[model samples]
Target: MSPLLWAVGSLLLLSLVYVAPKGATYILIDDNLDTELAPPFVLLQEGKALDYRSTTVVERLMNGLPRNALRPGLQPLVGLMALLDPLPAYLLHELLVRLAGLVGMYLLLRRYGLPGARHATLCAALALAWAVLPTYTAYGASVLGQPWVVLALLNLRLGPGRWSDWLVLVGFALWSSLVLTGVFVLAAAGMVLVWDASRHRRVAWRPVLGVGLLALGYLLVEYPLVYSLLIERQFVSHRVEFDYAQLAPGGVGAGLIGAVRYFGLGQYHAGLFLRAAPLLAAGLALAYVPAGPARRRLVQWLAFSLSILGVVALFCGFYPQLIGVAQRLLPLLRAFNLSRIHFLTPLLWFGVLVLSLRRLPAGWLPLGLVGLQLLIGLSMNPEWTLNVRRLLGRLPATEPTYAAYVAPELFARVQQAIRARTGQRPAQYRVACLGFPPAVASLNGFYTLDAYQNNYPLSYKRQFRPLMAAELAKSPALQTYFDAWGNRCYLFSAELGKNFRVAAFPAQVVHEWAFDAQAFRRLGGRYVLSAARLQHPERSGLQLLESRTAPGAYWRIWVYQVRN
Candidate 1:
């Protein structure tokens, strides 16, 4: 088959794979709440961009950064979504981005000198199949920067010999740096440049210098912005201290083993069938290939892959003891997800495998493997598709037929209750959820004090910690309870709720105290929505205004007026 036909075929297949399982409703993992749902909602409602630093309540309370610290790469897409309905726009956007990434991957493979046209086509098809596997689907949809990161990596491999290439690189670099994953792409590009220089025995000064200056300029401007919003505000409440005991079983070796297993194979049940044997075989065969661009590229990728995996394992495994020494020496490493390092691993593994198989005939071998992977992905789709269906309430999961997870009927009832009781707009009142997931409230377009996000301002935590302490002090059982739970438990209490805007205490603390109605009123909470019976609801002075079950009688939403 011609390369064009191959490209079109792969695009169609992957598009179907992506769209089939997705609904015109939110997917509830990772940044679905913060990045996917809230930002676009805020942009449409307020006619401005919202990101980690901007949409956050503490940032708003402090009037901290005048602008969002996040890059505006996703703004254009978000703007377009605002013009249409969010659910349809999100599904369409996901389809297009995945398609674009696939095309870019094919082009990158072709440029990497993967021998014949047929070989390149087959390799690209395999890579595309691998890319859309269930393991990555959730992230691909929720994370805005992913497709751009793929395109940026492609440009990195293709190099910046041309003026246009340089321009594209700079543009993508600037745009991508808004997402933390983009930073890793830039780092990978730097490694590529270093490898090129080492291979050629001379510096590629122009691109090297160009990347350096651009990065330095970005950091100069963005560092203060991030530091102010994140570091200075103590939003790094999620910073994890490395613990050696958690690594157990085998210490560093066990950590490395777990990282390799989870990162490479993924956590999904389908991933049990998606073994690493073929990819590992390809990697091992890299040693036998003759010295050339393909071999050199494979070597560079392998080294890059191992380096990322090793760094994460070493830091997480040895933790506070050994890793703390490194953290003191290099402070920036303090705030990072060791597991996220795996985000790039599958792609790199695909590169190594595809390049290694370039010499084989473009026939059944690649096609069979691709088909098997696709089948595995399809098998997993039913559960996800069912979930989307359940969430969207039997509505067609298509464009122009979007529905929020909170049924329109239920939402209207809740709104009516609040309006009747408060004589104010829903957005005017700071709302909290007692037993329901916070996202449900946020999805219904309420200005909920409850949220689920990564970072929270330290000020909010400090303000709230006293209430928690008071509660714990009142209940010796609670103090004993947390003492059993440990330090990581306390971190969530300090950070997660305040950052996410959830009004209730952290799970570890919630069971210990009766709901403090006076504390809720003091914190400016005017409404409390509960899915379960509230503890000491009378003491909290919460008046139940309305109660009704959601669609399918799954759970009841109880709206209460917080009597000041």
Candidate 2:
């Protein structure tokens, strides 16, 4: 290996291994860990029978059937990684990320060799920029399939070496939903290759056949998502707006952790460069030089086009639909469901910059480019922040505390009560509980049936509320309980005679998949039953069992046995 490339490799590895690890921590309590994302999918795999949206899709694929379910609101993305093991896909995806990085770097650089070292160096710079970004890698990395988009980019740039390259692109689409929007970045690039081959009069059949094959492959692979989105979009109003006024810089200070979330973690950090200005400058400056052959003129053209379409496509897909709400570009810019869609923006910029700097002498282009990136990043500095300090001060393990706060420690107590009454035979019970943070995971351990969130925030319409209220009225004793969607039945804490601003309804939210503005409402549980039931005691064939109490600030359980 050449010394220059070897030196570049070492630098990349050291920055990711040493500097990156020191600045980040992945445990809960930081608010950004987003761990709840994976539990349900893994829960199903652990033999519990239930499904979230992603899990539903994957389940259908594995079980060989199409689902007719339609869910409302944003759902968690954790189901994919959760299907494998006990530990909720944490370390597994990190390993995949590291592996993708290695593969991305090797293939990316190899492809760059044709363009010569200077341009190749620029492509290398995209790695460093995205690696440090918060949305791109920081919180986003906690997600398992996060790196495949960039990995797919690497393969697309590899210029169709083996037939396996096409398979990799298809594989990436299956693994993560984030790539769904940005995938056209690849589809567009592939179409260009077909165009170029036909223009050059070379092995033209490959490009034509590849595009046809790619189109058909994506059609088959994305059938579920395509079908779901098409039908869903037609009936319900996603209310997604893209009113362009939010592009202006606003009060995105320390408390607003989501400010640069759209810009990618690397770009986010780089955006506030006064602290690491010099270091970031070094990274960006070093990003513009590519190494390799002069025959890559065609490939370079394709990269440049992709770089443009990628930026435009990202803006169009999300921002245009989000204009009225925050009027913010950063939020809309997240091409995927998460906020890190801007990670590759720097990649495109670096590509053009590398092309520009390819002719410069040793060290000259690198220094100039780095300085430029810092100047631009510092331009958006959001008044100094305490975000870093707050992050460090969070509790080491927040899952346990959050668990206790959301549900009572009823496992051992419930197990004992059931065993004493029924000779310890765990039956296929059809148990039900109010949906909360920990109910589904906690209940399936000893209950009759699987647990799930009844629906809210996503599909909370005015008509649905009365039906739910009627159910609550029929079961007055369950006033303090959670309903099918896991909402409170109003006896414990009624809605206090008001509708929520977000939803404009008389409903309450227990949990949401992602941040929906409508979720920040006052949750209420009221029964639509006859006033007779509320005033008089209802007789039942139920008998009292051992009611073991749990001491906690959250759930208050009152257990009984039915002679059904």
Candidate 3:
């Protein structure tokens, strides 16, 4: 098949793969379901997407989560949620991100790595594999648009670039997060410029200007972050108290092991799959291939990419220790995760795959490698894997369909029942969740005192911490997780541990519920929505309000009202 045909075919297949599940079955947990969906939905629903006031807040989560804490509403992907329902909007988002990746990888390969029609099929195949990588859709174009950024940089560096190259950088800044992706991308670009300057013995002003433009774009797009961080410091961020030592993987020995693992497999958050095996095999194979210009170019590219990964992996492994020293001088170093440089590695690994495969004798060998990568990438996707498992009649009971996850009917019933019993609207009283994410309730229009927010007021964290203080005291790990890193300021149970997706069938009961009723009430927390049944209800000053279950509901929500 031709390159264009292959590209079109892969996109159509992806549409089927993602959209076929629709509401019945798809991933609605972790970052996508629990955290990301609610923010955009709330912003658009309340007509607060464009609200740029410093006081602008979404009352759905973290007890008045700042608008800046959520993704910017102006971005095209976020705006899609305003036009369409969550499912369609999200599917479109997935398609758009993958499409960006496909085009970006193909363009990068054609322009820099593999030029000419002879290499088109190989380029398409490699690009197809990259697009299929199971990255978090919530990240939008951050992971996927990386190749485009690199292409733009190379264009500016090599020659007088087209206006299209500038457009690529601007579009990237608009779609991607400054903290999650922008910082690292700019830093990587700067490092490359330094490397280039050393080789050429002079600074290339054009690419430097390109990098400056990209940075300026990020500043404009993510102005809220700039406002919060620099312009007007509203409240202390919970990240200020981030204890790197406790969060890091044990001592120096474990850190070294982590570095080695990172060098091989890459980080899980960055489209991680069967990266190490194929890349390693290809590199080893390339070493023994007959020496030529093609072989030399492949070797040089592989060495350079691998070296970057090695340095990044080592830095990440001992990040905690490095931060410890740095924080003593500049305390904010604790909040900044320098390890996000690993986000760039997945694209580099794919580049390695392309370079190595391009050097091989064309046919089944290259095709097989691409095929292997595609299968692995698809298998790693939660939505795809779940659907595959369901099709094969082997899906686990614990796994929930997207409909079951966002059960509007179930939540509506719960909402109506609460109103009938208490004569109070959802906005009148705050809710806290146990053995489940507070985001579930928040998305259902409940005012939750607890949430899984990336950024929020440090005062809120302190206020919420007291309610679960006793529970934290039970487990040292939980104590560190809450006290040090308190992003998930939910009502934690010692018995439930970290299992947020509680199944109703097994009826997981918490024997000892250590909760402070006064503290909860002080935070205006009138309702406690729990998945687990408490052994002694009165012990926590919670009276069971209602316990409801339905056919397709993920949780058998037991509503408990605090005794006044």
Candidate 4:
């Protein structure tokens, strides 16, 4: 098939496999549902995306979260989200990210990996697989657009590069996050430059210049992060207490297992396309290739890829010890995760896929490999899986569609009920969620005392700790989770443990609730929108205001008022 035919075919497949399902029954849960989806939608809806003021507060979340705590709005994807409604914006973001990957990888492969028209179909196939790798849309093109950065750098390294190469560098830096992927990308680019310089015994000024441009772009785009971390010294972030030691594997065997799992399958947060098949394909290609430049290049890439995996594995394996020592000395190291370099490995593995495909002779073999990858990508995608299950009438009652997840009508009823009961609007009082994510409240325009925040004031964390202290005492694991990584500073239940998704079907009950109502009220928490019913609410100083249920709503929220 020709390039145009391949493109059209891929787009159709993307629509059938991804876009249609997403439009129909978008699954909203976990990280995407709680942390990422709401912020962009809320910010855009409330007309706060353009507000660059540091003092600006997003009143809907964290009892007035600083605007800088959310993602910066100086990107194309953010602009796109700003233009559309929540669901449409989300779908568009997903589509754009996928398309960007497909185009970028195809162009990169055409320029460097496979240089002829005969290889165009294979390039498209590989790129399509890369495009559909189930990376989180909230992250924009951080993982997918990596090939664009490489292409831009390679263009500069080869010669006086085109303006498009410079455009790619700047555009990628803007689209991606410095904290998430940009910093590591620059590091990788710098490594390449150093390696080239060492081999050639000379410096390549163009690629160096390209790298500098990309870094500068990141600085410009990530001004919010820069300002918050460096310029603003008023509030220390809760991330300062992040305890990697508690999370990391303990013994050598367990560490090795952790390393091996990560090296092979990758963490879900960082584009979790399993690398086993690709690694096997690469190994097979390396073994079979003739003794020549092709073999030499294959060997070099294999060694390079293996080295990266080895370093990442070892770092992950001994992360507890390494981070312990580093944090003890610096203390600043606790806030920032150095393990995120693992983010770049997915891109490297895909690159390996391209190389492995090129090494093989033209046949069904390469096509079969591409087909297998695409299948894996689709199967691994949570959204796709949920949609497929829903389509087959097998979706669990716990799993929610986009409509059911938000249930704007249901929340409106709750809002009205609260106002009728208290004679005050949602804005006049703060709320926190129990047995469910605060995202539901936040998304429905309620000012929440508790929220899922990647970065928030440490002072707020300290204040919030009191409310959950008794519950935390019962569960040492919950204590560590909240104190060390208090991202989800919700009202944790000792009975519930870490299971927050308390839907109506399970009929969850918290037997012995030890909530500090005084602390909750002091923090401006007027109501607790709990999915789990408390057996002894009076003991916790909570008056059951209303038990709300709506037709199509996932949660049977039992609204509890903190008695004065």
Candidate 5:
């Protein structure tokens, strides 16, 4: 098929197989809710882009905004979706981003001199694999800007021969920095430059100049914000640590095994590296192939892959305990999970495999492998298909919940109860969820006292540490509400009834032991909602106004008006 036809066909297939299955609208939950939905909602609805910085308890206690230095570049994309209803807008944004990555990947392969048909087929195979790959799909739906970052890196590798090329390169570099993934771009570009220089026995001035300009641009854009945040210690302090067992040789080995399982060549397995021996051998053989362009491309791919792994290894080796016993001290590492970078591993292997396969009789093996990968990916991991089907099925319903993280009917009922009880406008008063997820309150636009985010302010740390210590002293059961960092709260759990001390509240009011009604009121919370039954509904000055089970939900929502 012609390139145009191939492009069109692949685009359609991807949209149908991946994007459309998720439907036009779906609820965001967990990290997706916080990063993609809440922040964007704040920016679009309230015109307060920085509000997310202070939404967390620690951030608010700090008296100033927490440093939200990352992902500032996503504001425009979020803003563009303002007019469209949220679900469609989010779905559209995700689709377009993935499509851009696909196109960029194709162009990148072509730039390396891969033939048209071969590159197109590879692109299609990638799309197929990505459609069912949970990690890639999750990241794509997130606001992390990973896909755009990949696209930017591809553009950077195209080399800046024209003035427009230079403009695009610089623009993307600045944008990448704003999104906080500039580190990867910088690392990749720097590695390529060094490799090129070493090969030619001379400096590659253009790339060096480009790198300098990019760094200058990033500094100009982000340094001030970071500096101020560091001074206040308002930046996110969560340290991501990997078990030493999960690093490179072990983790990579497991991933290879998982990939083999994904190809249906082996039995289902848990470790990522189970059947990865042959695949690794194939990749290694390709890495040493004699074709000039293929060798160069393989070297570049290997360098990029190693650079990412090296960073992870350095973190695991240097800072095994992301945050030591002293909770006050900030962690050296910010991004917690290095495993997310493993998303690039498949692409790296694919690149090398394609180059190595170029010399083979090219009709069936590539197509067969692609088919096997897709089949195994879908068959072994049924959630991909199930999730897509659920999303699509829920779209026609009045309010569809994603993974049941937030029940739309329950959320609406809670919002109504709050409005009726408070006799105030929506979003006017702070709220707390005793035996429910904070997202339940947050999804309805209430400022929640029980909230969590990566960035917690120092003031909050100081304030909450003592309070948490006091509470834990009173009832050790409260330990369940606090994370290892002791800076965030998690009240929602199946064992909440067992873990929370009910007697902590003045009235027989439902309590999670982490916060009493007084503390709730102190934090400007006027209402406390519990999913579990309260021992004394009318005790402790809290008026139980509504106790009703939400339709289609198992738990009952008990809404209380806290007394002043």
Candidate 6:
């Protein structure tokens, strides 16, 4: 079969089955839109631009704006794609990721496979399996950053003619997700260089040079915007702490597996996949096969590096989350912004397919592997881990609705009143919430704020404001007061609620709603809801309106609307 033919087949398979999971982003990334605007705290401070000194999301978001000092040179490209298509850039990112994965497989095979059309066909077949590997496509397609990171890895060694191409791929890599992925690219290049030198008795400066130039191009394009954000946006002050030396396992897998058993995901992917799994065993059999050509050996090295990533990903799986807790503070590693750690499979196996292509038995190996995957798919968990949720769901739990919102809403409502009383639009507004979503809602534009380090809750809890917000605002030679009180509004979710870390208010409002979780369980487990505005229509906008808008029974919202 022709390589082109295989490429077509891979594309067809990807289109049919390997797409983003509809609800996968629900836990953190999807529900949260503030990440697109900037950090919540920065928006609170009403800084439309970012400061150069900081490397946080707030900084990147603000810097991406035209007026920001630390400009995102490539963020506009993402934003542009979003604008042209009338789709969320998040969704658009999924599109890019799928394509990048396909292309990456092609390049992987091109570089390592035997000289013939078989290389392309094998790459296609391998890509088909990988793209459909529930873990890789569904998990990864939902993410914007990981796919770009995969592509950047592939283009890091493109031929000499396209400086422009290098700039785009590298730029997208640095621009998307956490900027630390750029560092990942650099490390990959170094590892690639070392492998080449040792394996062939000669260092391949070209690959190394390509990667370096790409990195430089990334920084060159990104600096102006991000640097500005560093100066302009307070949220830019936040930093992710990563510690490579302190690697440990976490029970990410268990937490999820527990969820699965509790929620039925246990019966979905893993359980089903494991039941008739010989095909999986056979496909995997190829991964462990013996040696191939020198180039194939290079593929092996890349695969090894990816395996190390897989091991690192176990941080999200085995240590029961304490390890992941500590991971948030770690430097470069934190920026990988991994939600589904399993997404690494495609990137890793792309190399495996490339290296193992030569040794693949021609006759029935491909069909056999596909059969193994299909047979195994039955036992694996198709849904996600839901044990804790299911266990808790089985329990009847309730807390009083009174003041749950006001306890936090008082300060917030007062701030809203104050903003209304003053009739000033503070230029930009930010509201500190569990995440930045509501803060972005306070006004029309975006804000700079912090997330509670992805899904892992802040160890600080009530003090999370001081812990989460203040740190997000702190830059060199800064005061604690400056960091803590720097925001305009704070939103507290009464359903899953907290007062956060700060206490200040001139305006606030609290509204509550009640929904029977039991009703949903009884009615096919569906929770129905609607919202009403407590405050009059005249009170909408600024901070005052949040108190006006109240949710159904299952939730309550407490808002602190600050003066501009």
Best by lDDT: 4
TM-score of each: 0.72, 0.48, 0.95, 0.96, 0.70, 0.51
Ranking by TM-score: 4, 3, 1, 5, 6, 2
Best by TM-score: 4
Model 6, 1-564: lDDT tens per residue? 665466556545534322223211211122223233233223233343333343333321222222322234245434433344212333344445546555554554555443466445555655444333333221222222333444444454444435544554555544442243454545655776788679889765556666666666666555644444444533332323332223322244565554333222212211112312322332444465655675466556655654564454443344335435556555434434442333333344334434443445555765565445433332231211221232244311222121221222333443455367556442334333431233233222323232322221122223233322322333321222222222222222343233232122222332432222232222221111112222321232223334332221212334433222
Q: lDDT by residue for model 2 over 98-193, one digit each (tens)?
A: 345434543454455224554444444533332332222222222222333344444544455455755655554444332323354445556666
Clashing pairs in 1: 242-319, 449-501, 450-501, 450-502, 451-500, 451-502, 517-540
Clashing pairs in 4: none
Name the runs in model 3 displaced over 4 angstroms.
20-22, 277-281, 284-288, 291-301
Better of 3 and 6 by TM-score: 3
Between candidates 4 and 5, the one scoring higher on lDDT is: 4
lDDT, each prediction: 0.49, 0.35, 0.81, 0.82, 0.47, 0.37
Tell how far residue 216 is off in model 2, in angstroms.
Answer: 4.1
Worst 10 residues of 2 by lDDT: 525-534
> What TM-score does candidate 2 reach?
0.48
Residue 530 lDDT (model 4) = 92
Off by over 4 Å in 2: 1-43, 46-88, 113-160, 190-208, 211-223, 226-346, 349-361, 364-564
Residue 87 lDDT, candidate 6, scale 0-100 = 23
